[model samples]
Target chain A: MAEHSVTAAALTARHQTAGSAASVRRLPGFGWSVGLIVPIMVLLLWQLAAGGAWIEADLLPSPATIAQTFWAMVQDGSLANDILVTVYRLALGFVLGTAAGTVAGLLTGALPLARRLLDPTLQALRSVPSLAWVPLFILWFGIYDTSKVILIAVGVFFPVYLNLMAAIAGVDRKLIEVGRVHDYGKLRLMLRIQLPAAMPLYLTGIRGGLGLGWMFIASAEMMGANNGLGFILTNGEEIGRPDQIIVAILAFAVLGKSTDWLLARTAERLTDWQDKLHPETGA
Target chain B: MTRRLDISDLTKAFGAAPPVLGPLSLTLDGEGITAIIGRSGSGKSTFLRCLSGLETPTRGTAMLGGKPIRPAEVGFVFQEPRLMPWLSVRRNIAFGLSHLPKPERARAVEAAMALVGLSAAADYLPKQLSGGMAQRVALARALAPRPDLLLLDEPLSALDPLTRERMQDHILHVAQHIRVTILLITHDMDEALALANRVIVLRGPPGRIVLDVTIPEHDPAYAFPRDRTSAAFQAMRRRLIDALEPAPVALAR
Candidate 1:
């Protein structure tokens, strides 16, 4: 009987580190292999096009020439500095935007008064097609890092704000009833029931917010100032160096894809208890 | 620690709609399980919800052990398991026990799991469990708090026939052994007869009790998973079915 009594405490702790074994499922490994084939084929075709005379060397530099340029930039440490600056801006902007959006979304979704006061203004701002903020922001904050970072933040805020609010509002009434039965106070109900229930959709919103971060950063970097991947693109164009242009484009591609892959993996771990009998990574 | 429930003139209305249940009153002794049998939309869930404090009554009050009923003392299980998908079975059962000290809460959770035979599945998520297994976890979750009154809202209605019957037996065993006043809402007459010592038959769009029957534990007909072929069980089943039918209209001569 004593042993039986202790079992409950032990059972409750078991899943804390077990990573939700029951929800584990076989991912479509074959489909992933098939998906990889298409990208590899595309890369090979581009290489062939450059190797043959199908594309002019000066107009669309050979893949080897682009690779050489990429190595030269790497050796000089310019490539590393560019990546560092751009990624730093994106990180700082994304964190600020995400934090602000979460607070706003929580208030709006949970309280009618907050929605009435804030939602209309936010929604109106969201409709302003974002890029239109560029010139005005530059005038106000100047062409330093502040305007650029703020631009990326403006782009990120909407998706997180919208998704989190909707997700919280859409929580199941039945689950709320469960909280009522437990006689939970407002804070406990929101923390334990509303927040966890809203998380899967909220994570999806973060992915959207991050995508917009990458989008806004390109235009923000293009506007002014020095060392960044976007600057390299403009600089190569000014100098008529197609290989350098290709190097910048390739850098952006790798950075964007790898960051997204990292996010998808984290989300998969966090939401393992989700109903993913079918793999909808939605990443 | 179970207590008798005394209900008086309890009525619920939504806006301009007529009262959904009761201007009626009854008392239930906390001797064993009492099942409420009614047709769909007969305010079966509404009544359970009212007692669970999920819905407020338009009039009157319910008292447990001669005092005004506190919502905290009531436990409710819905038609579906309604478990938090992200929580393990063990955590879900421990949900209502946050008010208890850690050691006591653990003991209570273990006891509830043992009662429902779900101790082995404590680490599983709701999505991983079969329908019957999920329902058992729900039963444990409700029972863990040791409520003075437990209300079940057609908890087995979603299961297949085989699983439903199996759960019926499980409910019978749990009710017989646990000291709690359970008010069960079920459409199935067999389920009502199998589990309850007192079966309240209700009728209405504006719900009211039509017949309230009690079977003594010593009565030869009082059987767990009531014998379908038995004459006594069949007769009682027909009475409940007939009570649910609409009243006959007066003929114009």
Candidate 2:
């Protein structure tokens, strides 16, 4: 508990220092919060349209109606359950795909023979979109969660694979020469030199793959899943409840932004030198 | 402990071509720096690479301490500072010292950082350093291993004038402190004179050593042709320059 308080105090101090620093530079609270302006404007416009009878009220629900529907869903516990299911699937698919992609990328990148044999096939597979595999996946795994997870996994796999290959290949050849001079074995060379050198690129690939994986999660659910935000939207469509559909869409956007924001924050914390790219951190 | 490098009748050829180095024989006395001065494409870099075991000779051999040169036995500084971007200055210097234990490794890193005057910037990333600072880090990286032989491939050739002078002083200072045998390849005649006690000039096709001269200066200072018009320095510089010129067709054996 003492250690926790110490950490909390340190965090509070850091936050205050950063706040003062931002004000000194005449900077806003958070640079990326500017992106929220678009959604806020859209919500205002949406409220105006739904209330002003610019279109049929049933066809286009107001922001207030959507918020009320969302609150109702949350109170009943169905939205929480759906979100949990969707997040679980996304996490599982990300882990599986990232693991498989990293291993394959490292192996194929380091060996000429493996690269020659695997690259062409992986390249061909990557060109096929994730949605195109839905029918085949449904046939293989039925309308179960397994099919949705696999779809998301495949969707997440390609970005990671491509980025990892690029990272591996893009490692400075001179550093490898240094490793050779230092009598480092092949395994040592890969682990000690190549892998750490390629980490930034690998992290980028993970973030992108995670984002794409979440996108596929909703699409997969929409096609034929019994649970998730996509299922809620599909059910609402079938039952003619436009407010529930809007709430579902709003929830999807919130989940996507939340995960993305969390990943980026984690990246910033881990790779402190990369904080400069965010602008708000002032490097 | 003395380690002598003998390159005996070392000849190398590639793909049905005549040899780049042929039946070349030289024994380097293993106490101090020996500079090999040659024009570009005169195969000096290749010879150094072969000597360092980055390449294998098609014929003959290079033996270190009368033993074959194994990888990592000799530390090599390339023409460029090829540091990993992800690693900081201290990490780059300590890169090859991973074979040491934890305490020894930290000591070695500290020693290297002090030697390069980079202890203050130890936490700074490589991209944050200037070109000269990066090159010094590379030099410190090579020096940290405390190898028996330091093989340099024209390390100072790429630096600007002011940085080059500072680096030369740095190299000389480090060489004096460490007492490692250095084999430096340079086309700069003055640098060869300033840093090396013994200079060997490479000329002729299927290259062979044409001139070998020892600079008479002991405990040399960092000042350059400040006295450029001095007859002795001018005379010596002229001799080295003339030796670098192409051989006459009129002269026949």
Candidate 3:
């Protein structure tokens, strides 16, 4: 704990020296090549395995076959449509879940009455698996976009709510005292000090929620949705098309990674104050 | 207008047991500096917090300018520089001045920053500042609203010796320039002697003022380093130390 605070202090000091003009550091081309090496090697191993008939082609499609199937799907507009539908569902559910969770978390974290009345129920509810909600949701909302969206929202809510509440509850009491000394009212205290102090944690919650959001999309789509990446996976399975199945799996991987990357970049910008203080100095 | 503080029969208790501060009474001038000296757990902090309205007194009245002292009328600096890490230096300074109009608030923040020699660091966040610099920002934040009473709870104790000395001088400068009623809490006898016109020592389970010594205003030896080596300073320091020392075992029994 002492060492952590010292490092934090050092980082903040370094950030102060850098001032307001944030210098953007670009990765070298060599870095990109270094990053790609492992992926390329894995692809090569997989291709060699397929060519040598070490694995059945039907069970595990070749990278080339998956790429060809992906291209064909893209040409026919189905890949784009599937990606769009899934992304739309993911975005909408994530926003709703995050919004509701933030409100609930803030309320419970700040108010004893709210915590007493709501926290136990929410905690019990969250323990139930995300997939467990699907049957109940389908019965209530029917096997349409509503059920899928609600399922994803339910998945996203727990992580965001739990993390956000913990973050708010953990805000330094000393900092809050500073606000109180300044005569900040309840609203100002929460908005200006507490919320900003809780932001790094809130962002963590959002990132976790986003990951869960994507996970639930697959579950949601696999059950009933007919035009998403999950739907494509289900369709490929029914038709025994390993190549198409591999393409859908690859699409999910790329989409998840890309969105996570985007969230990470946003988090980096939001937490520049913290990052600048304790920058990663060595390999 | 300058505000005179009259704290009468002020006492604070945590639970039903011994009070942190016993019933104590003192009157302070509306200007210049006064330092409180005590050992650890001396209730000096409790006294300061009560004055700042951060903690409610168990019993007693603390009045400023013939009215009850409100939190708004006082600015407090804690032992640690409790600056909001997310806020820039300018924003932290401006934190209390939000009650003012936007332009006035901005001007107040700018003036406070300039007063503390932090104009160059206005846009930098707290994480970017050195220990001394962050403490300076905390001081600036306290001063921005121009409160009549400034309560400092060992604000310079955390800094390195050299930085602490420099901060002491800076605080002395601010005290003289602003003419605000200053109540500083410290364990350092030399610090109390150097910076304050009056020093009060508190010691007890239920803490009360045990000694009140006035530094001669006209003595050249009472000023900073010149006073450090002076016989008068040494005599005063000795007196304060004797007063702060615990009672003998026979006397306690």
Candidate 4:
């Protein structure tokens, strides 16, 4: 009986440890597993295709060659500087675009007169591609960080604006009626009910907007910029370093995805119960 | 002083159709449960909407509490719970009382939950609830404000038979305990007879009242039929069925 009790206690302890561990295993916990698999798969596929005579070696270098080139570039410190520059541009543009777009979208969506007056003009502006604005931004702000940042901001603006407008427009009419029934004043209604209700859509827009901002910054920098990943790629072309160019492209893609993942985690924490089954990301 | 409701020649139309309710007059005395019964598309719900200020009368006047009735003062339970997807059951109950102080609001929420037997599921979200539970939460929400008049538009038309009977009993218990007046709209004649002191029937597009029967018994238990096997209960049921049947056939009889 005593042995049985001891074994039972041991089993209980193991079960408790397993349960706690299970609870601790959330979405981000799986990120490392994903991270480990993707690069390994890419490397294995690339090495097989290139080294096994599937593709021309000159066009698609072996994975070993690419790794050697990446190590050399890292040791030289140029790649690190380029990454820093690109990140800085993304941060500035995203902040400016999101703040301006959200405010403008809310105002336009809420007021009929404002929507009628501004919607046409904004619609026309949104059609102008992010690349199309490059020349104008260069003329307006010069071939510097300012011009690249402006281009990125313009790229981020349309998606966030459209989403915010939709979110504001979609605030439930029944809930607004409830607010009126409670005799809640205008400020209270907007702040407490309308804004919180619109949060899921707004955060989703912010995520897409940030991704677009990062994408535009790299492209804008490629067109004309003193420093950034785009500059590194341009220099690569000048020096015939195709490997560096490919690495920069890979780094940009990875960066965009990581930033979006971080934003999604933040959204999950903030709006835990708001949109329990949001159509997008299903978080 | 308790106020009376006077609806005079109330007419309402939608789109290109003729008026749903027209030239109909109703004067409701101080406080009691009045059930409006009719077949589907008989404009019974529309009449309830007009009374609740969800729809305005095109060419008539509806005065309540000796003044023009405002939507805010009349609490309405929609066909569905229509609870905010994000709010908890308790929050939905207190939604209409947001302006109240935190403590008083909490107490009111607890009281309303107790009334609807949803005190244990107060923290559950609307989607987490069963259909009957969600409707119960909706009832608790409507009742929290202690409105002078509560308007329910087929609030229990979705529940199962067993649940519906229980809810009918619950409604009766609440009407007996509270001073609030209720205007219930339903197509179920049995439900109308079970809970209402006075029953009004509406018929057709330009909906008009066809029958108005005041039950003899005031007691909640067996309010419709003191004993289902009794002659009085059977007679009342037959009369109500005849009243609901085609007017031409009833006239021939």
Question: By lDDT, who's the top model here?
Answer: 3
TM-score of each: 0.92, 0.88, 0.93, 0.85
Which ranking of candidates, highest TM-score first? 3, 1, 2, 4
CA-lDDT, candidates in order: 0.84, 0.80, 0.87, 0.78
Name model 3 segments beyond 4 Å from true: A1-29, A275-283, B224-226, B246-253
Better of 1 and 3 by TM-score: 3
Residue-wise C-alpha lDDT for candidate 2, range A126-209, written one tens digit per residue: 888778989999999988888888888887787788788888888888888888777788998998888877776777788889
lDDT of 1 by residue, B209-252 (tens): 99898876787776555677788888888887778775565553
Identify the CAPRI category of the predicted complex in candidate 4.
Answer: incorrect
Question: How high is the lDDT of residue B64 in model 2?
Answer: 82
Model 4 lDDT vs. the true structure? 0.78
User: Per-candidate interface C-alpha RMSD?
Assistant: 5.2, 10.5, 8.1, 12.8
Top-down lDDT ranking: 3, 1, 2, 4
- The most accurate candidate by DockQ is 3
Alpha-carbon error at A12 in model 4, in Å? 24
Where is model 1 more than 4 Å wrong at Cα?
A1-36, A280-283, B223-225, B250-253
- Give residue B86's lDDT in candidate 3 (0 to 100): 75
lDDT of 1 by residue, A101-208 (tens): 899889998998999999999999999876799999999999989999999998889999999999888899989889989898889989989999989888888888
The Cα error of candidate 3 at residue A99, in Å, is 1.2
Q: Is the docking of candidate 1 incorrect, acceptable, medium or high quality?
A: acceptable
**What lDDT tens digits, residue by residue, belong to model 3 across residues B180-252?**
8999999999899889999999997688999998787877777654458779888999999989995687887
Q: Number of clashes in model 3?
A: 5
